[model samples]
Target: MSYDPSGNAFDFHGSSYVALTPNLRKLGGEVEWDNATKSATVTLNGKTATVRMAEESVTVDGVQQPLSGPSLVKDDVLYVPASFFRDVFGQSI
Candidate 1:
């Protein structure tokens, strides 16, 4: 894994993914972890999204969408597909 000011980035299946927290923070979003469920809840602009590890789908604002790949948790850090920045959060990556 490699970290930039943006966040930790790594290659998975030839695509790049990034650590979720820093980018979410940068977007002014709040992230809450649910260790019991192995998931994270992200809220931004009154919208909430739930992402879980080893899952190919996520729920955004109570709606489910196909995730590009499974989310991953490593050493307490959450890594999400980079497309998540643009596709789900409406942030330019």
Candidate 2:
């Protein structure tokens, strides 16, 4: 599904999916993509989540959890599900 980012929520790709950089960074979360692993490491506060773009699950601090959908990268922006914030970072989303 496509995302929409607006205010505290989300809007789709022009404004962008979860709008990664702007919103996530504001939340004190950082994401780093690894081309070799095809996965991203997301750190928020002291929590760490590993999202593989081709997989529908995330590993948080060594714990594996299912995600609403797989993460994605398009036009160089990372698009993770809103549920990611809730499940991984303990944010309400």
Candidate 3:
């Protein structure tokens, strides 16, 4: 993960975590952030995943799914679970 002065990137429970923007891009997804709602819209492969900070619920392709972990925000950067790509995008890590 790239360094962020804001301290939003780190490792937890043996999983590496980074800010949402980079994670989205790494997954080949386009992201639109909504600061007001503290949510992110990620689009890839004709699917949309809407995730809200501090929420365990994610909407993928207009269907709601329970997340293994909540989406978190620290220092204004959104942090998603490391398994997000595998869980939400159907990709192996």
Output the better candidate (1/2) by lDDT: 1
Candidate 1 lDDT at 65 equals 97
Candidate 3: residue 26 Cα off by (Å): 2.5
lDDT of each: 0.83, 0.68, 0.77
Q: In model 2, which regions exceed 4 Å deviation?
A: 1-17
Candidate 2 per-residue lDDT over residues 22-45, each given as its tens digit: 566878788787989877787897
Off by over 4 Å in 1: 1-7
Predicted candidate 3 versus true structure: per-residue lDDT over 1-93, tens digit per residue = 344566446665555565777767776879998889878999877789999988988999889998767777777788877677777887644
Estimate candidate 2's alpha-carbon lDDT, on a 0 to 1 scale: 0.68
Candidates 2 and 3 compared: the better one by TM-score is: 3
Error of 3 at 6 (Å): 8.4
**Model 2 residue 36 lDDT score:** 93
Candidate 1 lDDT tens digits, 14-80: 6688888888988898999998998999988778899998788889988999878889766668888
- By TM-score, the candidates rank as 1, 3, 2
Clashing pairs in 3: none
